[model samples]
Target chain A: MSDLSVDLGFLKLKNPILAASGTFGYGLEFEPFLDLNRLGGFVVKGLYYGPREGNPPPRLVETPSGLINAIGLQGIGVEAFIAKVLPKLQALDTAVIVNVCGASEEEYVRVVEALDAEEGIAACEINISCPNVNKDGACPAFSPESTRAVVREVKRASRRPVIVKLSPNVTNIVEIALAAQEAGADAIALVNTFLAMAIDVETRRPKLGNVLGGLSGPAIKPIALRMVYQVASRVKVPVIGMGGIWSGADVLEFMIAGARAVQVGTANLVDPDACLRILGEVEDFCRRKGIERLEDIIATVKT
Target chain B: MFKDPEARIVGKESWGDYFLLTFDSPAVSALARPGQFLMIKVSDEPYPLLRRPLGIHSRKDKTLGVFFKVAGIGTALLARKTPGETLDLLGPLGKGFNIDPCLAGKPVLAVGGGRGIAPLYFLAWELRALGASIKILYGGRTQADLPLADKLRAEGFDFACSTDDGTVGRRGLVTELMEDEIKAGGGSPPALVCACGPDPMLQAVALIARDKRLPAELSLESRMGCGFGACWGCVQRIRRDGKAEWIKICEDGPVFPAESVVWEKESP
Candidate 1:
């Protein structure tokens, strides 16, 4: 069997398939669907210092081969996750990555600090690029300065390896990735959903309650691949590519484009067994190509 | 427990815009309960990314049925399926109706509206088998929408229907027929009220159940991303342990106690 394992420098995964944050919930929710041990890892839903009620209804809309959502990062808070969720997750064989989120920089550090005290957390994905919240202003990832500041602070507060998840809604995504890398980010995850909106013609109103949401699915795959290629070529840290990944071929394409690993986002919402299915496809492709180590393909794309 | 499997279509029936497709999916069918639903992949392609959530309409042995109307692109695609086609389905997901033993030998009211009538047929059949006397109240916009009325009656189910245009059993809302039934019963009113329909109709049923002091259960509808708990796309404001909170409709319930539901118009 072809080895599907991928090492992200600071964190080593059994395979390259990870259920993305916000899409996978707490990992416990998917216990009935598939074995968590079979997956490389899964990033849990975003958590703040305290519980959040999230945005109002009409939070999702389906576009052509895509879904736009503005869930506003509703969560049970970091402490609650530690108290309730982490213990259950400690039993699982898969890596548990906690996605840390906050409205302000201090809140981000606070969440990371809380998580730093806990065991069983493989890594912390610092989410400074969530497009659904901070409606009037740009997210931290929008600017290299803010991105650097937040990533540096989170890295300082977090003992676990920090993965800066970057947003695509930027002029220079590579600059942002470099800033995160400079600020001590161990890895980079790109690109968070593209900022998008849809309108209802009959009602003359926005489809989502938050007005705008992050668009993910097959619709954004090509652009995500390009961004991953650009940032991966520039940044020294490992890049976790995601956006519109639907199949095993899609996973290999991202790795070839320069991503060390890949996260399965919108596909999880559509197909519950997407992680394993995509993993199977990856194995089958490797077997067909007579490849032994999956890592041999990372950043091997021809210009 | 739920199963994600490609179920072969064993039966297919169409009545205008409404269609019923039965599948030989033993894994999901054997676990089917009234008010539960299936996340059906309507297309083989990725044009429609999310699966359509359809309620379990009927179950017999290793087969389960789903009845839906051609309301949107997803349902429209589902309606075009043939008897031999295989459907990728995830089910039977979510908490179904609470079949209390206390309901046995008791009078139960099953209210439905439009395609919302999908799960009520299965619910009534189960209630009847449990020795409870079941009365179904089905309503639609017109005669064409009440496609299951004749079939349900043919199966020896006690049924009543209503249409907005007055082309069917009653000229008013199905809630009106329910009120009439309750009023006609005089001293022997229904012990429980169960409803699945449009939000407004469900609200009306909740109000009716409240005024009559009867226990009620309502199957709600929401635009769902995942028919499981992952996406947190479909949420409803519900009161749990005397405190109001947003609950995942896909997992916490597609079925919930009437009193716990906080309606859309109501302030939290």
Candidate 2:
């Protein structure tokens, strides 16, 4: 079998396929669908300092080849996650990455510091990119300065590798990516979700209760690829890419575009076992092409 | 375990804008209960990217059925599917109608409003199997909409129906029909009420349940991103412990007690 493992410098992943945050819940929700150990890792839903109720109804709307969602980062808080979810996750053989979120830089540090004492957490993907919440311009991923500030704080508080998740709704994605890396982020995950929205023509009101949401799915794959390619070309840290990955071919495209690993986001909603299926496809492609290792193909995109 | 099976479509039936497609999947059919639903990937393509959530209509042996209305691009794609084709289905998901054994030999009522009637048929069948005397209140916009009325009759189910245009059974809303039954009986109301339908219809049913002191369970509808709890896409405002919270409808319920439902406020 062609080797599908990936190393992001700080830690080694059995494979490049990961279940993205928000889409994968707390990972335990999928225990009945697939073996968690089979995946490289899965990022749990974004957790703040305390439990949040998230947004109101009409949180999701499907567009052409995409889904716009404003789930507002509802979660069970860092304490509950450590108390309830971590024990079950520790029993499993998979890497459990925490997607940390906060209303402020202090909250982010607090969450990371709390998680520092936890054992099962493999890494912390700082979720400064979610567009569904942080309406007060608090989304750190929107600006390089704020991105650097939060990533620096989180990296300091986190004992595990810190992965900075970036947003595409910015003027300069590469600049923001570089900022995260400079802040000592062990890795960078790009293209969280493009800011988008939909409308009900009959009622003339926004389809999402939040009026605007982050769009993810097959529709945004090409744009996400371009961003990952651009950012990976410059940033020194390993780049983790995601945004609308549906199949194994899609994951391969991200890797080829310079992403060391790819996270399957919206596809998880389409099929709970999408990661396994995509991983199989990657394996088949590798074997068919006589490629022995996935690392040999990272950033192999022809100029 | 929740299974995502590529279930082969074994049967198909159509009536204008409505259709019923049956698929053979032991995983889903075995675990499926009344009021549960399935999220079907309508097309291999991504234009209609999200899976369409359809209520489980029937379950016999290893086959399951989904009754749906071609309301949008997703359902339209699903309607074009023919027998022998396959559908990617993720189910038997969400909390279904609670079927307590005490319901046996008791008066049970099932209500459906148009396509909302999808899950009620399976509910009626299950209730009847438990020796409960089942009565179904089915309604739609016109005669063409109440396509399952004859099917329900053929199965020897006791039912009543209504349409807005007076094309069928009663000449008004199904809620009106329910009110008439309660008043005309001049006796104890049904022991339990199970309903699936448009929000307004469900709201009316909840109201009826409230006034008559009858226990009611409602199967709600939402535009779901995933039929499983992972997406957090489908949520409903529900009251629990005297406080209303946004509950994930895909997991916590597609079925909820009528009293817990926080209905939309009627326009002034």
The numbered model that scores best in DockQ is: 2
Candidate 2 Cα outliers beyond 4 Å, as residue runs:
A136-138, B266-268
The TM-score that candidate 2 achieves is 0.97
lDDT of 2 by residue, A191-298 (tens): 888888788999999998888898899999999999999999999899999988988899999999999999999988888888999999999999999999989999
Poorest 10 consecutive residues by lDDT, candidate 2 chain B: B259-268
**Winning candidate number (lDDT):** 1
Instruction: lDDT for model 2, please.
Output: 0.90
- Complex DockQ, candidate 1: 0.76
What are the models' TM-scores?
Answer: 0.98, 0.97
RMSD of each: 1.5, 1.5
**Worst lDDT window (10 residues) for model 1 chain B?**
B1-10
Instruction: Give Cα-based local distance difference scores for all models.
Output: 0.91, 0.90
- Give the local distance difference test score of model 1: 0.91
Identify the CAPRI category of the predicted complex in candidate 1: medium
- What does the lDDT read for residue A248 in candidate 1? 98
